[model samples]
Target: MSTTPDRVALVLGGSGGIGRAVSERLAADGMAVAVHYAGNKGRAEEVVTAIDAAGGAAIAVGGDVADENDMRAAFEAVETAFGGVDVVVNTAGILILKPIAEFDLDDLDRMHRTNIRGTFVVAREAANRVRAGGAVVNFSTSVTRLQMPTYGGYVASKAAVEGMTLILARELRGRDVTVNAVAPGPTATPLFLDGKDEATIANLAKAAPLERIGRPEDIAEAVSYLAGPARWVNGQVLFTNGGIA
Candidate 1:
């Protein structure tokens, strides 16, 4: 791909399944990347090492995404190493599935803290810090649109993400930073497949027109577009779900 040596990106949750893909993909495209992890230092280091092995620039940053001070430090770490951050992608999130009544209130609070509060903290930092012509990409879920049962709390958190994304885009005005969210359908990741049976997975996979599950790379491609050349595509949720409506 084309390389832009001057560009830099910070991928929050860069140690996780989809986050790892986005970190690697951004690094491959020649953006100096900061791989931010909440806990998995080894996984984050592996991602950074892979990028370096591929002749790309990357560093691993650790912080609590929902903590303002922690996120600020993560941003500072990137800015310190990369001069300035051109793109900020918040893929750090939590997913807990259960019927609304069946859900423990503490679990709901935890999900809200990570998924909603975390995005707010990251987006606020990106809003104040991202250079002109930069981008802020947030993660949402197709469950919001699909209205899947047992996903009420998760969907609620992501729905808050969608609202923040649109409002942030408008708030940026002429700042030239495109704010958007990517909503992906069921993907083959450990977090998603943990308790799911083959039959259930197959059914969800076939629900989409593509008749298969999405890959992390597939969602990363959408993020790449928003972060790079899709200047006019702002204030929208791009559902990269392979025609799953």
Candidate 2:
């Protein structure tokens, strides 16, 4: 709890499992927040309501993360409501898991469009609109390092995100903006647990030294650091996976 009462943050995919955690966490730290949802305005509004119930300021925004025009409007809406945006966190992405051989080309294209293209679209707006001393936090996956099977497509998309984040940090030189990506291991989110059974879950949980999977709050804490006081930690991928490496 330290508070940045004057700051503002826009969290893409703020309605989802991990994204909701980040949105609420940022709000708890006194940043006015815009919760961006892909299509579920109701879910996004629920997160906003929760933040407001907790004495925080938040609003729901909706857009196609991969669409340039849609993302541009999202930035405009936040700027209009909050005066300026200080942190832009992109957690809006798609995950399609299949072996490269079994993956449909269309699925690969869709995943890249949302995960890779969406990240850059948000970054493009943040590059011009985020205030000085702000941060752009993108989401990646620990599977990129873990090299898990059946995750080739998903990992490819996130790997692109890692590269994009690193280069964006360097490109923002002299702008006082820190660009970074958070790569989280298997977290107990609905998305992660959908097709998994107890045995598989147990195995993943034990893969890390902590003897458990990550929590959304755990990942949010890393994002909170990058968005707040970690000024020198730029151009890097912080794998917040409880020593899974």
Candidate 3:
């Protein structure tokens, strides 16, 4: 919400379902976007193409959020393409759902690497580099509040993100930057729907007060609001879960 006109935004994980939506929404809102992806270069290019077709400026960049060098290169690429970045939206994360007792240690490592460590790396970079009057929007999950079974690992990772967002918001006090997180509920993304049966998915959708699963755009709308106009909304986790949490 603290962004300036003609500002640039870097969307980490811009190739995924929610990430693509966030990239498009930010572009529509008139911000030149830097679309970042880790493994999906083609999908990242697709997002860039859409933005360009809409007469918006965008470029696709690749990096792993957990690597300092990778994120540094990503930021450098954004600056090279759009002068300097004013907003950073970190949607790059992994969700590994399993009972704690049976959860694979390797899976735990992967989730932490991408969700917690990656978020910290990106947030630290944003804290030091983003221009004044900028905004940093991180991703969390509503499962933290719902405490759903088999979501222990994923929720724990996002909880780290939430804590970091609050601390960073205060850390950016004199710099005129706002840091927040968007906690979305069960959304209809490939990541969320991959292995579910029709009946199970329908039941989950009906559980929300809205009686439908979230769309990526629904979450993107929240990101757009926090990134552009909600100047006083720092240090908050805006949940876009349709009242499920």
Candidate 4:
């Protein structure tokens, strides 16, 4: 509740299911949002329009998060429009599922390009440009703990994010900025539900004590906490999975 109306957030992957939820949640909480998309300008624009319709401030930005130049321009655009960037929520990622023995190296390469390289690209930008008293939220996954089959490649990328995020939190010493990651379990988003049959989905839903998969808004609530009221929290990977772990 200490958040102000002027704080600005650049939500990378803001066009996707979970990312859209994060963007809207941040805007609703009073921050002007720059909804960043990789290749979907229209999807990003839709989020911006929704925020505008809700009487909140928002704009859409485009970039490949794995590219440093693109991300730098993204930060510059946000700073120019909003005067400064205070929060960065990177919900951007790629998830490819296949058994490790059968996984293609090219798939791993592609996933790492976005899920790992892309995350750090934005992290570096936020560290250099985010104003004081800002927040940086990275995304992780509960599957890193679940050790689920066919998730090895995807989990590897997120685990890297978890490591880099914890280290970055300490590296930002004296900057008064908080860095953290949220790990959600089997969220019912396109990212999590795609390519799965009903039986697989049902099994995942029952894996959690909550007896259901997470909602995008459920995960967004955790990001809102880290990005807004939970200043004392830092350098941690929060498992926002409804006790799936």
RMSD of each: 1.8, 2.0, 2.4, 2.1
Task: List candidate 1 stretches off by more than 4 Å.
Answer: 1-4
Q: Write the per-residue lDDT of candidate 3 for residues 139-198, one digit (tens) a residue.
A: 999988888999999999999999999999998879989999999999999999999999
Using lDDT, rank the candidates from best to worst. Answer: 2, 1, 4, 3
TM-score of each: 0.97, 0.97, 0.97, 0.97
Instruction: Score candidate 2 by TM-score against the native.
Output: 0.97
Residue pairs whose backbone atoms clash in candidate 4: none
lDDT of 1 by residue, 23-42 (tens): 99998888999999998899
lDDT comparing candidate 1 with the true structure: 0.93
Shift in Å, residue 140, candidate 2: 0.7
What TM-score quantifies how close candidate 1 is to the native fold? Answer: 0.97
Q: Mark the regions of model 4 whose C-alpha exceeds 4 Å error after superposition.
A: 1-5
- Give the Cα error of residue 88 in candidate 2, in Å: 0.4
Model 2, runs deviating above 4 Å: 1-5
Error of 1 at 208 (Å): 0.8
Q: What is the Cα-based lDDT of residue 185 in candidate 3?
A: 92
